[model samples]
Target: MSNIPFTLHTQNSAAINVSLLYAASSKYEGEWSGTPHSHPYAEFFYVLRGEIDFQAEGEPYSLHEDDLIVINPDVNHTERPRGPGTVEYVSFGVEGLCMDPADSGMWSSCSLFHCRQSRSEVRFFLRLLLAEFENNLPNYEQLCCHAFESLLVFLKRAHPQELAVTAPKRTARECSAVKRYIDANFRQPISLDHLAEVSQLNKYYLAHAFREYIGLSPINYLNSRRVEEARVLLRDTSHSISEIAGIVGFSSQSYFAQVFQKAVGESPGEYRKRLRRGRQEKQE
Candidate 1:
C-alpha cells in the first residue's frame, strides 16, 4: 500500500495575492486521525466526490458530493473518511479577504457550514474547479480562483438555510431586480419608501413580498450590501474609512462604524488591519 498520508498542493502563481491549496485522499476509512487543527486564513472546501465525516466543536455531520464546507479561521475541527469511496476536495486559503462569520447571516453563532449546491449552475462551477485541480493546466490557478468566487456567490444566493433564512422561490429576474437596486443605491441614504418606489410596489406589499421572496427586509438587506462593499474597498484600496463611508452611502463615519461593528463583529479599521496582517503572514 502507498504510504502517502495526505497530499496538500499549494499554489503561489496567481497574479493576485491570494494563496490556493488543493488536497485529495482516498485512505480515510480507518479510525479518525487528523489532528485538531485550525488556520488563521479562511478555508473553503468543496467536496468533489464521496463522503467525509466532520466534527466541529463536538457536533458531527456528514457531507456528500457537490457540498461546500467553510471552516473559518481559528475554528477547532476534525475530519475522517466515511466509506470506501475516494474523498476529493479543494481548499482555498485566501489572504487579502476577511470574511465575517456574522455577515453570512445564516448562523447566529460561529460554526462550520456544510452547504449543498442543487442548482445546475453552481454544480457546473464546482465541477469545473475540480477538473482544474485534477489537471493543473497552465493558468489554472486564475481560472480556479474565479470559479471559486462564482461558487461563493452562488452559495450565498441559494443556501438560505445555511444563512439562517427561510428559503423562498422567486424567478432569477425578480431577485436580480431587488439585488441590483440595493447594489446601486446602498451607499446613498435609502429607505423602504425609495425601495418600494423603485420596485414599483406599494410600501406594505413591497415589504412583505421582498421578505418572502428575498429573505431579508429592505433595510437589513441594504445594510448588508453596504457593509460588503465597504469591506471590499477597505481591503483593496488605500481609501480612508471616512472616504469609504461616504462612497458607500453612509452619511457619517460613526454611523458606518456602528453598523459595521454590529454586522461584522469588528470595526472597519480593525477588519482592514486583520486582512493586511493575513496577507503579510502568507507572504512570509
Candidate 2:
C-alpha cells in the first residue's frame, strides 16, 4: 500500500498531542459527497441517523445509525451518499494520541469498526462531546479530554474486535539485524518485499514494526543512509556527481540532488563547496 513517509518513534507518548477538532452535527449533501482525502491525523465518523457508504483503506463499508468508523492517519478514503440519501454524521479528528503499550499496538493496528454496539451509550458520549466543545465552560479543556478518553474506553470495552489483532514486536536482535543490513547494503535495490523476506516478516507487519521502531520506511531509511554515504564521497573523494549518484544507488543525478537537498537542506555541489571553503579559510 502507498503511504506517506511521516512517523515518530516516541517513548514518552504522554507528551503526544491530542485534540477534539470540529465536532458538528450536519447533513451532508447527496451530490458526489466529498473527494477522497487523507490526513496526518486520525478521524472518526459516528452516524446518528441515515445510512451511507464509507470507504476506508480502499474497502467499501455500509454504515448505519450508532456505527462508529475510524479512519487512521494517512489512509485515503471517501464517502458517498447512498442513493441520494443524506448522512447525519458527527465527526472529529485527533493527532499524536498516547495509550498503554498494548493499547498502542491495537491502536496502530486497527482502523475501521463495522459497528460499535450500544447505541444509547455511544450517543450519550457523542452528545457530551459536542456539548463540551460548544459550551467552552471553565476547565472545559480538561473536561473534554476526560470525556474523549472515556468515549474511547467505552468503545474498546464494547468491541473486542479492536483488541483481536495486534502487531507483534520485532525482537531487538531482528531490528538490529535489519538496521545493519540496511547500513551495509543501502546501495543495493532494497524493496519492502526484499526486506520482509530477509526479516521473516509479512509486508504489512514489517512496514508497521520497522516504522514503529525506526521512524521511517525502510526505503526512506535506506535513502538516508545512501545520502550520508554520498556526502562523504562528495567531501573526501574526487568522484563526479553522476558517479557519486551511481555509488549511492540513486538512479539519476537530478534525483540524487533532490533527495540530498531534502535530507541535508542543501544541494550536493553547494554542500561540497561550503565544506571546501571552510577548510581553506581554516588554512588561511
Candidate 3:
C-alpha cells in the first residue's frame, strides 16, 4: 500500500481555471492503499491499463481496462488494484458543476454512479481526453469539458444500472452492438432494415430504441456519419469530390455537396479552402 497523494497536473490550470479542480494520472501496483475519501467536486476516472477493485459508498464495483466511473460530489469511495499488475488511469474533478436529479435525462441526469460498459466507447473517450491533456492547444480545456459531458451522456445510455425505466433486458447490449456496426459500416450504404436485422429487432422498435438510447435514428445517424467522414476527407485527403463522395457512401458528388452544405453550412470546396487558409494564416 503506497500512500501517494494524487498529483495534480498544472499545465491545463490556466484554461480549466479553479472551477475545474484537478486532473491527474496514476498507476497502482499490488494493492489498495489510499484513504477512503470524499470530495466536494465531482470526479471522473478512466482506467487505461489494468483492472481496479472499486468501492463507492460501500458498494463494490470492478473497472477493467478502458472502463469509466463517475463519483458524484461527496460520494465516499476507495479503490485498489485488482491484482499484482499495475493499474494506470487518469482522473479529473469538476467544481461548481452539478446535474439535477429529476432530469433523469439519459446520461445528463445527475447521479452518483455511472459506468461505461462498452470498451470501444470508453477507449474513444480516453483517447480524446488524453489528447487534450497532452496538447494544451487553445480551447483544449473546453474540448475536454465537452468530451466529459458527452462521456456522461454515453454512459447513461450504455450503462444499465443508470437507466430509469426498464428497457427490454438487453436493450443497452443490443444497442451497443448496433452502434458498433454503424460506426464500422458508416461509409458503406447501410439500410435501416439491414441494421434492424443485424441487431435482431424489428425496424420500428430498433428505430425507437436506438433513438431513445443512442439519440439518433438509423438513417439520420448514418447520414451524419457520412458527413463526418466527408469532412475528414475534405480536410485531410486530396481525393476528388466525386471519389470521396462515393467512398463515403454518397451516390453522387452533387448530392454529397448538398448534404455537406446542409450539415456544415458551406460547400465542401469552400470548407476545404477555409481550412487551408486558416492553416496558412497560422503558419504566417
Candidate 4:
C-alpha cells in the first residue's frame, strides 16, 4: 500500500526541530477560570473529554471534545470549561520550533491555530508523544520530534490556505464519506455493497473514486484502519494476541498475524513485546 507523505514544508530552508520540554494531563469539572499568559515555548493541547471555551488573541472559540489548539510562542490564550461534565486534556510545552512563528503564514493572522477536522491524526501522534515523553526510551526524543512534525502536517492540512505561497496543498475529499464510514465501522463485515450504500454511489463507481482519492481500494483501506487500531491496542492494553486480533475485526488470530506482519514487518506479539521491553528498560 502506498503511504501518504506528510511533510513539514522544510524545502530549501533549515528544518525546525522541536523538543518536548514538559507534558502533563488534567481533568477538571465545573466552571473554571483561566490565567491569560504567554511564554517563549509553543504549547499543544487537546480536549480529551467534555468541552471548553478557548480564547486566544481576543477571539473566542467554543471547542468540543477532540478539538486541538496549538498556541504559538509568546501568544496569550486561555481555556475554561464549557459545562459541568469533566474535561480531560493532555498538553505539552515545546521549544525550538516557534522561534519565529511568522515564518509560517498560519501564525500571521492568529497566534493560536485550531485543527477541527484532524482529531484522529492529531491524537495518534499526541498519544505517541506522551508515551515517549513519560518513558524516555531510547531515541524517544527523536521520535517526539517526528510526532511533532506529523502534527505540523495535520495543522497544514486542516487549514491549507495558511501555507506558504510556494507550497501547494493536494487533498482528496470526493470519497471522504466512504473513508469515514469504513473507519467508523471497520469491525463489521464490510463489502462493496455496504460501502456503496453508505456512500450513496454505485459499487463500481465508488471503487474507482475511492482508489483515486486515497490510492487504496475500499477493502485495503479497511484492513489498514483495522491494523492501525490493533497497533494502538497492542501498545496500550494488556489484551492477548488472539483477543486483539478479534477486537480489530480479524476473523482469526493466524490471519491477523499474517496481515499485521505484512503491514508492520513484525508479528503482533513480537512488536508488542519489543515495545514493552524498550519502554521498561528506559523507565527503569
Quantify all predictions' global Cα lDDT against the true fold.
Answer: 0.62, 0.68, 0.67, 0.69
- Pairs in steric clash, model 3: none
* Pick by TM-score: 2 or 3, better one: 2
- Model 2, global lDDT: 0.68
Q: List the candidate 2 regions with Cα displacement exceeding 4 Å.
A: 1-17, 98-110, 114-116, 164-284
Compare candidates 1 and 2 on lDDT and give the better one: 2
Q: Which stretches of candidate 1 lie over 4 Å from their true place?
A: 1-18, 23-32, 83-88, 98-120, 133-136, 160-284
Q: For model 3, what is the error of residue 247's alpha carbon versus the real structure, in angstroms, after optimal superposition?
A: 1.4
lDDT of 3 by residue, 96-147 (tens): 4433223243312123332445666756765776677667788776767666
State model 3's lDDT. Answer: 0.67
| 2 versus 4: better TM-score goes to | 2
Tens-place lDDT digits, model 2, residues 53-153: 88754457888777777765555678776777666888876654322224443223125444445666777877877787777777666666666766766
- Show the lowest summed lDDT stretch of 10 residues, model 3: 1-10
- Model 4 global lDDT (CA atoms, 0 to 1): 0.69
- Point out the worst 10-residue segment of candidate 1 by lDDT: 1-10
Best by lDDT: 4
Rank all candidate structures by their lDDT, best first, as comma-separated numbers: 4, 2, 3, 1
> What local lDDT score does residue 25 receive in model 3, on the 0 to 100 scale?
81
lDDT tens readout by residue for model 4, 1-284: 11112233453474444446776778887777888776565677788888888875556888777776666555566888986888999887765444223344222212344555677788888888778777878877678778877876776666555443122111123355466567678888888888888777889987876775456889888889899999999999999999998898888999899989998999999999999999999999
What TM-score does model 4 achieve against the real structure?
0.48
